[model samples]
Target chain A: MSTRHDIAAPPTEGGAAPGRPAPATGPTEADRRRRARLSRRWQRDLRWSPYAFVSPFFVLFLAFGLFPLIYTGWASLHQVELTAPTDMTWVGLRNYTRIFDDEFFWNAAKNTLMIGIISTVPQLLMAMGIAHILNYKLRASTFYRVVMLAPYATSIAAASLVFVLLFGRDYGMINWALDQVGIGKVDWQNDHWASKVAVSSIIIWRWTGYNALIYLAAMQAIPQDLYESAALDGASRWQQFLHVTLPSLRPTILFTAVVSTIGASQVFGEPLLFDANKGASGGAEHQFQTLGLYLYEQGWVNQHLGRASAIAWTMFLILIVIGIVNYVISRRLRASS
Target chain B: MTTTLTKPEDAAPPVRKSRKPRAARAGGHMHGGPIAYAILVLFSIGSLFPLVWTAIAASRDNNRLAQTPPPFWFGSNLFHNLDVAWTDANLGEAFVNTTFVAGVSALTIVFLSTIAGFAFAKLRFRGRGALMLLVIGTMMVPPQLSVIPLYMMVAKLDWTDQLQAVIFPSLVSAFGVFFMRQYLIQALPDELIEAARMDGASSWRVVWHIVFPAARPAMAVLGMLMFVQTWNDFLWPFLVLTQTGNPTVQVAVAGLGRGYTPDQSLIMAGALLGTLPLLLVFAIFGKQIVGGIMQGAVKG
Candidate 1:
């Protein structure tokens, strides 16, 4: 990282004064000669200074951001025992093969998808609804917007803890509210379905407002004439909404969908903190163990770096596919509309 | 729906009959009467309930919290809970560590990304377009997927258990650079750079004098986003800082809740303590935060 300082290296003699152009004439007086030299230096510096200016991001990215990902791919091909450095064995595709056969990996992947779908679908729909409401001439709109985003500002650790307590079996508020409506006791932690719902609820609670605000911004950008034209065509309120607003918000909807998908697949802290007794296992039976936590459990907890690297590569591949699909869909939507 | 306003231009008026011309009244009840307010207020209460409950729980003892239909009012145990969280849960050390890490990291992100953003937006250079595209492309690849190799890199550097392990990797965010670049492209004019050059100002001088000051607002938004993100960051820190007394606030809060024999009151207090700084930030910069999100969403 100390190499980052080189980005601000002192300008060379020919690069001493940047951003100034060189003189056109060859022969000159001493003062002119000196000024021309200085001007030439500035021109040279200007030619290359953008590289210097942008080096920090690349330098840091190379060291910390990109290298780790590449190293993970390399390590995934080898059986590197973390505790015994000298015992590394070249095992091509074995780790990936083993992961394919591992139930925990599949389980974690399943839970990740389940929670991702359950949490993201409802959350996005609700956000669109809320954004729709806020897009109107509401009273105290700023106050509502501010309050809506308050949950987003809270730390996941804190928010999940609050939810964990709220999801408690005997003394939890959720169950208490349920009981008043004649529902039975819910073992939120132990029951597999209930635990997933609890984890998803925390995510939905934390992010719905954030997505809503984004939707609202997109909604506001829709030209007023579009809505008016639809209204004048004898379209009902619902027809105008379906034709004018939803269609206009297609790109934004796709953007949020992809962003939320990436976020949902990486869900971790909530489940880890939600089940106090289970630690990173997610639950007593690993009921809600997401792929993110699975990667952690394999690498750090179990000291299986090779398998963890495999998992990391798998996640990377999954994200790449999803990202490309999202890009294509968004482009198609833009082209169509 | 029943309004007979047929003209396309006049259609905007009858839809929003009372106020705010051409607001998206595609849905019925666009005027948002008391019922809309009621629904919005209900959702707001639901959104705030957890934080409110956390505050209420933080003031109460574990005995009261353990009761069925747990105590909903404030108790006299606030001091005790704070003390327990500070000393027993090691939240004080975590607080200091998180503040140092988040503060320094946010500052670095703002400074570095501002320069890089200016360069990307205004500078003409070889491979500038390719590099910009590369930076944006990396945004799709999340750090979580590379956590394993990142851990190895830290281990090779022997930086595990050190704050640098957490802070260094986060100093330059692609999203921050992208955001700042997008903002600078719109906010800055090439004429300004050209004028500075005509006056024989060095590139560095031009950036510092003309660009930095002009980009301060965008820099502030990037700084706030970075600070909040770093402060809330969990998984990376949780992996690196295995030592007990050296945890960040979020990790310590996780530990408080992760244990089997956890004290509910202490966990509540820790959660509140961890969240207080960011909540204060939100209170002051709520509008900017919303704006930042919209900007990212629109461009993204």
Candidate 2:
């Protein structure tokens, strides 16, 4: 720590504070030559420092990020296990074929897509509404913004655990609230649709505020004059939102939508935690099993590393397809607009 | 736009006229009516309800929680649950592990990203733009998609069940690099770098002295983001650190809900313990975090 403090001390002591540049002094010929010589020597080393600075990330990425992605493709071809990876037998395209035939894989995929859509659509809409509301000059907006992000601060595991209690079948607050409202007690974890709703509720609860804040930021950046002009033209708040805010927020909306979709597709922790009683298969019947959980169940629990690789690659393709679709749609919107 | 507005007006003249004031030019101190407030309040409650419920449950023991209506208020068992969480639940070790991993990872991310950001933002070097773009591009590739391979890599390095399995993989975030680079581009000037260079300071010295201090607000935001993310991360840690000894707070909290004899109060207490520190941090640095996320989203 002291060594670090020592290394850091010189710049703080010697360099001017931000926004204040050092004053230029007239340099004598001798001084200029000395500086040039020093610079020439330093320049040789300086050329590589940026590379040195940036290499750590790329190195980590290559090892952990890119290599894994590419290796998943290679590994999926072979029949491998977590423990005995070297004794693998290559069976090209067999794992993919096998996963395709596996009903559990399809079940998991459907669950993932269902939950992703169930969570994402309402989350984004609520986010937009909240952003619109918060964009207005409201008292204690900062406090609301902070409160909105409270769920974001909570770890997914912790949040899911809390939700488990809330969504409890017999003693849950949700059922209690429903009972108070004269509705029947819905078995949240047992029923198919109810479980999806319960799971999506967790996702929605966590992300809506975060997405709203993003939209609010974009909304804030929209020229205030646009709204004023719209108002001067006798447009109502609804009309202004439709004609002004919504149109202006297209890029940000698309961006957030794409990001949210990508994130939702990889829903792991919530379902994993939500399936507390049902083990890691998502449920006894694999009701809420997402692809992420399936991958874990396969690779870690079943020890079928090859099959997990196939699932990983499948997820990658789905994301890429969605990404390309989003890109095309966004580009078209930009072009038409 | 005018034609569209007129069309809407024609379609629903009375409804449009009635809603006019609500939409009355933007930038007012208030938006929406009592209905909007009601909706926001309801949604806010919905958002906070789970945590509130958990807190209530945490205060109650198993029997009280199993009551027909369930306990809705603080019970005497709060301390007992916390004790169980601390001693019996393995959360004490989990807390220690989480702090160590998150702290180390956040510090490393900030340090590496800031320098890389500095290099990308101000340093004139060959392939700088391309390299920076490559770094930015990695953000598009969701890391979870590569989990299988990453698992193998960790295992190959014999790092499984270790905290470094979590820390090393996350030490340098592409998002942090991009975020820092963007901030530096706007906050820093080439004149500052040249000025320091002219002062007979080494390049490293110039960066440490001039660029880093100036980049603190950005770095702090980035570091806080990383810390919170690492604290909250589950899947990677859950996968790598399967051992009871190495479990992160999040993994430990997850484990609370997974057992055959799952204790509601203990789980709730454990969740609270895992969540509260970051929530407190959120309360303190909420504005900066909000700003950082907003800026990141907007810039993207």
Candidate 3:
């Protein structure tokens, strides 16, 4: 096996091929001994350096990340509340059982999945298209790329609030524009499906640019030779993209998909802001409620600690399952490739 | 490497032919071609319209805003609305509180992430591989899962309703550390550190002088992300900052929509104010923000 030095190149070094350079001359005995000693010292340093470097992350994770996760699992098994005294009572699986029967829980789960599908499918497809357009030679490409990320960089609270005004039924700019173009105003926040659509549009707008940039990077990494080969076969631009580029982007595609799914599952701020009229219930009917919002309302608003903890664990489980599925699919794709 | 040398000849024809259409279009003076400049101009306007509208709405009275085709021009109610929002919601307090929380949280995050990142990139220690994986693995665990437990922990510590509750939980971010590490590893050279070490500089001194300056670009990017995230964060602050006067901008904005019968102009004004700093940051460091985001995304 190659030594650690062989693998120490930065990932951005363009994956240089190995075994090309040969030593210029045979080493003298003294030089060989010095080199061997240096290598041994380097190996010793390598063994300890990585651990010291990564300790903060693990330390912080243990306190903030892993500990909280384990605590949530423990909290899920008890019947508790915010104001209730901390008494040890473990009703195993009862929290999960209650979740199955809870109408709000199911609504939140269904809404999460619905919004996930609505946002993820088009958001990614459009992102792929945008990335493709972006990858081509264009004037002011840098400016456009910068402008594209503005929405993502902007605060979610701010964007959702802007959308709230834009999607207003009576005096919204969108309705005003639509009226000019001979279209009628639509009630954006009142109706269940309409509100979801409105909320989903915000998600799509904010994230499409981010994912597009990711895809653009992956696209840049694809070998120019592959496109050249396809072109030599009399392939059109579309053909080259479909045959050479899209397949090359599968890993990134899966990555973004899983990440988007996780994001969608926890869709909070938009729905929270959008349903501001209903006072944090995520709508009067809870139509636009998601798992994250539901969890918040339960834990903080209603003070249903046990149920909220259960919902959180369930969301975590779902995310893990999705992540595992994504991993499996990516591995299969890699193996096949 | 072999493929790079061999493919140029084969690749030449298609690229040359593909250029023909663009050249033809340019020659024909097709000013508004399918890839129209107009579309770009329109989208830019669309992207910025809400902000423009907010300014107009903020300046207008409720009467004017309630007009059929809402007043597209400004009116003389900016001070009146500001006064009402201020007195009604104590928005001024919220602003101060928010600035404090976001500022402190961002500073701490930058400090911790930098120290941790430098160590990860340069320091030699045991169990580094497992620790690195552990940190990376935490990235996959959604924040929602931990919210409940974190809230409970905060409650146990009696830190609920305090700004520390908001700032402490947010101080450690995986992405911040990851980005800082990546940037430092790439931007800083081993020779600089070796020289610093030869000069009898301690590890901390070497990092403070050498690594920190080299990591500014990445620090700016991480700082921007953290600031925007903290400023805009809604759920945690909303939960912890149950006190009306202590609300962050988001919680305050959401309260505006809730406490009053949803006034478009007021909400627009508030939202506009909330988003202005972010927009300003983008405007100032638009290039850096773009480069950082693209770099971070690419690596991810």
C-alpha lDDT of residue B187 in model 2: 67
- The list of candidate 1 runs beyond 4 A from truth reads A1-28, A84-87, B1-30
Q: Give candidate 2's whole-model lDDT.
A: 0.80
Pairs of residues clashing in candidate 2: A11-B209, A137-B29, A237-B23
TM-score of 1: 0.90
> Which ranges in model 3 have alpha carbons more than 4 Å from their true place?
A1-53, A85-88, A176-183, A223-225, B1-39, B122-125, B195-201, B260-262
Q: Estimate each model's TM-score.
A: 0.90, 0.89, 0.83
lDDT (0-100) at residue A273 of candidate 3? 83
Q: DockQ (C-alpha) of model 3?
A: 0.27
lDDT string, candidate 3, B1-300, tens digits = 232223333333343354346433322221233564445545456556666777788888666766568677788887777667665555777788888998888877887788778777766565556666666777777765787778777778888678888887777688787778776666666767664444334455555667676777678878887887788787778777863647787777767666463566676677666777777888788877766766676557
* Per-residue lDDT of model 1, residues B208-240, tens digit only: 767776677678878998999999998899888
How would the candidate models be sorted by DockQ, starting from the highest?
1, 2, 3
Q: Please give the DockQ score of every candidate, comma-separated.
A: 0.35, 0.34, 0.27
| Error at A25, model 3, angstroms | 34
What's the CA RMSD of model 1 in angstroms?
8.6
